[model samples]
Target: MSSAAATLKQQKEDFVSNLSGGPVGEIHAVAFVAPVAVLLWSVLQSRQSFFQRYGLLAFTVDYFLNVVAILLAKTLYSDFPLLLSLLLAVPATLVYVLPPNAVSPKRKPKVPPSADSKNKLDPLPLKPFLTSYRSFMLISTIIAILAVDFRLFPRRFAKVETWGTSLMDLGVGSFVFSAGVVAARPVLKERAEGRSMPWIRRILGSLRHSIPLLVLGIIRLLSVKGLDYAEHVSEYGVHWNFFFTLGLLPPFVAASQAALAFVPSHAALALLISGSYQMLLETTDLKAYILTAPRVDLISMNREGIYSFIGYLAIFLAGQDLGMFVIPRKLNPRSNSSAGVQRNTLIMTLAVWTGVWCGLYALSTNYKYGFALVVSRRLANLPYMLWVAAFNSALVLALCVIDSIFFPAFYNAADPKSEKEAYLTATSRILRAYNRNGLALFLLANLLTGFVNMTMNTLEANPLVTVVILVAYTLAVTSAAVLLDSYNISIRV
Candidate 1:
C-alpha cells in the first residue's frame, strides 16, 4: 500500500480505538439505545395498564441492575452511590404506597384508637424483616470484609477499590432506609384514613411538617465551614444535595398526585420524559464536557440532576401505581409470601441479576461508545443508569418479600382500636421520626464520618488502630441511635 493510504487507515483505526477504549475498537451505539427504546415503547403502549399488568417489577429489576453496570463503566461514575440510595427507598416506598387507607374494620370496639401507638408499643414482630434486613446487612458486611481482607471474591464479584467512599455509601444507604421508613407514615396514613383535606392542604401539610428539619439540613450543607470540613475528608463527603432533594420529594409526590387528577395518564409522560432526556444526553457530545469539569456545573456529572430525577421519577410513578391500584387490593400470595423459598428465590434472583450487571459493566467499560447515557443533556452513562435501575428494583422486591414474611401486620393494619393497631401505629411514628430528621441525620452522618477520619489522620496512628478506631466510632454512633429509640429508626449497629 502507498504511504498516504497507510496513514489514512491508521487514523481511522485510532478514531475507533479512542471511542472503544482500545487501539482499534468496535462499539455498537445500538446496544446503549436498546433499553431506553424498549422502556419508552413499554411506557407509551402501557399507559392505560397497571405496572404489574406488564411485569413492570421485573423490568424495573433489570433496569436497576443495569444501573450497577453503569456504575462500573468508569472510575468517574463511582462517586455517586445512587444505586444504594435508591435501594434503601424501595421498602419505604412500598410501606407508603401499599396498605389500606381506611381504618381496618378489624379493630376491637373497646380500644378507642385515639392514643398514639408509636410511643407506647414495639412494632409488630416482623421477624422476617428483622431477619432479612439483619441477614442482608451481615452478609453485605461480610462481603465487604472479605473483599477487604482475604481477596477471596473476584474484583468482578466483590471488588471495591475505594473503602472510605464505600463506607460513606453505606451510611447513605442507612440514612435513606431509615428516612424513607419515617416518611412513609403520614403519607400512608393520609392515604388509608381518607383525608378530607384539599390537595393544597396536603402539600402544605407535608411542607410544614418537614420544613424545620429540611432547613436544618440545608444550613449544614450550605455552611462555609462544612465545605471546609468536606475538604478535610473525601471530595464527595460534603453532599448536601441529597438533603435538599429529599426534602423536595414528599412535596413532589403530593404535587404529582394532584397532577394525576388532571392528566389521568401522567405515568406515560414521566417515562417519556425520562427516556427522551436520557437519549438527548447520550447522543450529544455533552458528556465530554461534563466529565471534564464536574464540580463547576450542577448537571456536569451525577450530582443529583435530571438523570437522577429520571430514576426517581420512574420510582415515583411506580409508587403511584402500587398505591392507587396494587397494594390495597391484595394480589396472590405469590406477590408477597416471605417464606424460606421466597427469600431464597429473591436472593438467587438478585445474585443472578447482579452478575448480569457486572457483565454489562465489564462490556460497556471495555467499549464505552457502545452504550451512552440516555440523557445527552446530562453526563449519565448507560452502565450507571442501568445499574441504578436494576439494583433499585432488586432491593425493592427483596424488601417486599422479606417484609411479607416477618411483618404480616403490614399486609393488613386495618384495626385502629386494638393492641395490634397500637403496634402498627408505632411503626408509622418511627416512619415519622425518620422523615422529620432525615436531612439532619444525613448531614450529621457525613460530618461524623469525616470528623473521625480527620482526627484519625491527624493522629497518624497505625493502620490497624485506624480501622479499630473507625469501627469503634461507627459502633458508638449506632449504639446511641438504638438506645435513643430501638425501633424508631433502623438500629444498624
Candidate 2:
C-alpha cells in the first residue's frame, strides 16, 4: 500500500482499538493520555514552533473528537469495521491523500490588523478547556442515547439507537457550535473596525442572539404534535424533557456570564459546579425524588424524571467558556517548512492516540462487556466516568491533531482570502446556499426515526432485519442532517 493508505489503515486501527477497550478501559485511557503526555513534552520543548502555536488547539480538538468518535462507535454495529473504516476513510482521504497544491496554504498577504486590538485578539486563554466541557457532554449525551437504545434492543440493533434524544442533541449541538461561529464573526468584524465590545457586554450580546434561537426552536417544537399529545411519542420526536433542559440552557449561560463579574475563576467554578452537581444528584435523595416520577410537559415527557437541569446548564456555561478560546484572532503565519513539520507531527500524534485507544479497548474487555454505560447508573461508578473520560479525551485528541494538521490546508482550499473572510464567506454561503438549519434538519431526522419506530413497533423481526432497519434509519438521519446543512447554507446566502 502507498504511505497514505498505510497511514489511513494505522489510524483506523488505532481508532477501533481505542474505541473497544477490548478487555478493560486501561488501554483506552492509555491511548489518550500517552499522546497527551508526548504532546506536552513537544510543547515544553518548543522544538517545533508549529506544535507550540497549535498545542492548545490540538489538545482541545483531541478531547472533542474523542467524544464524537466514541459516540459514533456506540451507534455503529459490533461488526463496525466496514462502516467505521469508511467513515474515517472518507474524511481521511480528503485530508491525507489529496494533492498538496490542491489544498495548499494560501500566500499570506499582509493585511492591516483590525483597529480594535481586542477584536483582533486571539481566543481567551481560558476558553478552550471550557469548550472541551461542552464537547464532552454533547458527545456523552449522544453516546448515552446510543447505549440506551442498545439496551432496549440488544441483538436487533447491535449498535446503540438514536431516537428521541436526537431531537435535543442534534438541535442543541448544531446550534451551539454554529452560534459560536456566528457570534465570532461580528466580533472579528468589529475588531477590524477598531471597536471591541467589552467582554461582559459581548457575553450578554451573544445571549441575546442565542437565547432567541433556543426559544424559537422551542416554539417550533411545541407547534408540532409535541411529546404528550403525539401517538408513538416514545418512539421518536422531541421529548418534553429536552425542551425543558434546552430551555434552561440560555438563561443559565447568561447567569454564568453574570457570575463572571464576581467570580475570578469562572471557568473553574463552572466545571466544579457541573461535575459536583452531577455527583451530588447521584448521591443525594434528589435522585429518588427526580427519578421516581417522570415530568410530563412537552419538554419533560420523554426523559427520566430528574431535571438534569444543572447538568445541561453546566454544559451551556462550558460552551460559552469554550467560545472564548475558539474565537481565533490573527497570528503570524508560520513559514512553509514549519507548517509541513506541524502537519507531519500532527499525523504522528494522531497515530499515537489511535494506538493507545486500541490498547485501552483491548484491555477493557477483561473487566466487563456491556453495550454502553450511563455514568450515573452503574455500580462501577468511578470506573465508568473514568472510562468515558479516557475514551473522550483520546477521541478529542485525535480530532484536534487531524484538524490542526489539516485545517490550514482545509481552510485555505475553502477560501482563498482572509481567514475571517473565508469563514464568513464560507459560512455565509453555507447558511444561504444550504439548509444549514440544524433544527430543521434534526427535526426531519427525528421524524424519520419516528417513522421507523412506528413501523417496527410491532414487528417481531429476526435480528438481521432489526439490524438492517436500524442501520437504514441511522443512515437516513445522517443523510438528512447533511442535506439540511447544505440547504441551510444555500439559503443563508
Candidate 3:
C-alpha cells in the first residue's frame, strides 16, 4: 500500500478504537449504573440477614466484575463492549438476584394521607432546579479536567463527534435551560396576573437573573485573555471565549421568551430557525468564511459565536418547555389516587419521549443533510437538539422510576406528620453540595486544572496515574462543595 493508504488505514483504526467510549459506549456505562444502583437499592431494602452479613463483599465483588468487564471490553472490542457487558450482567442480576429480593416487608413505610386531599389527579412535583444545575456542573467538571489533565480514554472520546462531547453539550444546554426556567417563572406569573409589561422591560427583567452569570463570565474572559490561557479553538472560535457566549446568552434567551408570548411552541420555532440557518451554512460557503476568516474579522463579526449562541438559545427554550411540563404549578398535598395519576402521567410522558427519541435517531441515521445531520455543538443543529432533548428526557424518566421504586418515602417527606419517612431527602447530599456552589465548583476545577498543568507534565502522565489524579481532584472539589453546603454558603450566579 502507498503511504497515503497507510495513513488512511491508521486513521481508520484509531477512529474505530475511539469507539470504545462513544455513544453506544456511554449508553453501556449508563446501562450498567442504572441496573447496579437499582439492584443494590433492592438488596438494601430487603435487609435480608444473608445479604446484610455479606453486603459489602457483594458490592465489592460486583464493582470489581464491572471494572474488569469494562477493561476487557475496552481492550478487545471497538464497539458497544460496555453495552454487551451490561446486557450480560443486568439480566443475570435481575433474574438471579433482584427478583426474589425486590421488596421487603420491613422496608415499607406507612403514613396518613394529606388532610387537604381534594383532586384525584395530583400534579407531579417540580424537580429541583439545582438537580439539573449540579448534574451539568459535575459532568462538565469531570470532562474539563479530563481534557486537560489525564485523558482516561482515546482523544476521539473528546472529539466533537463522540458521545462524551455530546454529554458536555447537553450539560451546557441544560444549565442554560435551568436558568431560563427560573427566570421565566416570574414573567409567566406576571403575565398570568394580567400585568402587561413592555417587551423591552420584559427582556431587561429576564436579564436581571443573569447578572451573577454575566459578572462571572466577564471575569473569566478577562482572566483567560490576560493570562493567555491554553485555548480550545474549535470549542469557540479563535478569538471568542465561553464567557462571551454566557454573556450573550441571556439577551437571546430573553428575546426568545418574549417571542414565546407571541408564538406558541417558540422553542420549536427557535429550533427550526437555528436548524435552517445551520443548513444554509452547510449548503453555502458561509461556514467556510466563519471558520477560516481572519481573527479581526471573526472578532468583529462574531460569526461562529453568534450562530452557536442561537443554537444554545434554542436549547434553552426547549429546556424551558421541559421545565414547564415537569414542574407542578402548585404544591398541594393530594390523595393516593391523585399521586397514582401523577405517576401514570410521568410514565406516559416517558413513553412518548422514548418514541420521539427513537424517531429522531432513526431520521438522523437514514437521512444525510450534510453537516446538519451530524451532531455539532458549534452549529447546534436539529440532530444535536433532538439528541439533547432525548437524553435529558430519558434521564428524568429514569429518576422518576428510581424515585417511585426505591425511595417513595422520600417524596413529600417535608410533611411534619410524615416522620416515618426515609431519611434520604429529595436532594441527596452530593447533589445539594454541588448545587449550592456549582459555579464555585466549576471555577475551582478550572483553577485546579491550570495549577496541575503548571506543576506537572499532565500529557506525559501514566493513564492509571491520571485516573487516580482525576479521582483525587473530584473528591477535593466535592469535599469543598460539601463543606460549603454545611455552612449554608451557596455561591449562586
- Candidate whose lDDT is highest: 3
TM-scores for all candidates: the values are 0.48, 0.49, 0.72
Clashes of 2: 65
lDDT tens readout by residue for model 2, 1-493: 4675445444422322211112223223322332233233223222222222234454344322343344444434333534543554455344434343322244322223432234332321112222333333333333333233322232222211221112222223333333333333453456447884565775666465456556655664575444322222222223443444454455455446545657664335445565566566556875454444355564345444124455444434433333333343212223344534644554464366445434543453334663232433112122232233234434544545533532353233322234443233111111121124444444454565445433443234555565556545544544444355434342221
- Candidates 1 and 2 compared: the better one by TM-score is 2
lDDT of 1: 0.37
Better of 2 and 3 by lDDT: 3
Off by over 4 Å in 3: 1-137, 161-198, 282-284, 298-302, 329-337, 368-372, 410-423
Q: Which structure is stronger by TM-score: 1 or 3? A: 3
**Ranking of all predicted structures according to TM-score, beginning with the best and ending with the worst:** 3, 2, 1
Least accurate 10 contiguous residues by lDDT in model 1: 18-27
Error of 2 at 492 (Å): 9.0
lDDT of each: 0.37, 0.38, 0.53
**Candidate 3, 149-226: lDDT as tens digits:** 333444443335322343345555555655554545555556447797777886787576567666776676677666
